[model samples]
Target: MNRNKDKAWYIADVGDDLIYIAEKLNTKANSEDYHFENELLMLKEVLETLESLECLKEHSE
Candidate 1:
């Protein structure tokens, strides 16, 4: 399988989980119940990396 396609599929497969985490980050529970800033930051970084990969793939085509 193509690397980019594999990455895309992986992203799609976990899309719901990402959304859930993002929602949590925006909620009062996140502010009062736990310290998830680091994790959320990492998640955002991973998403940025995926976006960069897609952009690079498009330009390199």
Candidate 2:
């Protein structure tokens, strides 16, 4: 098994998980739950950074 490829897949999975959590938070938050806003924004930023990572791209065989 290729370790680098496995690592990339793991990162991608984490990104997906973050997206799901962010969506759930968005749906659950209300006026009284303003704290969720910061958490959601931070998740978005982390996902963006993950997308920008070159290692996430699949190399051509």
Each prediction's TM-score versus the true structure: 0.45, 0.48
C-alpha lDDT of residue 6 in model 2 = 71
Model 1, range 1-61, lDDT digits (tens) per residue? 5876876776775676677777877784646668887667868876786777778779878
The lowest-lDDT stretch of 10 consecutive residues in candidate 1 is 24-33
lDDT of 2 at 47: 64
Candidate 1 runs further than 4 Å off = 1-33
Residue 9, candidate 2: alpha-carbon lDDT: 77
Which residue pairs collide, candidate 2? Answer: none
**lDDT tens readout by residue for model 2, 1-61:** 5867876776877778787876778666644555666666767777676765544555432
* Candidate 1 backbone overlaps, count: 0
Residue 42 of model 1, lDDT score: 64
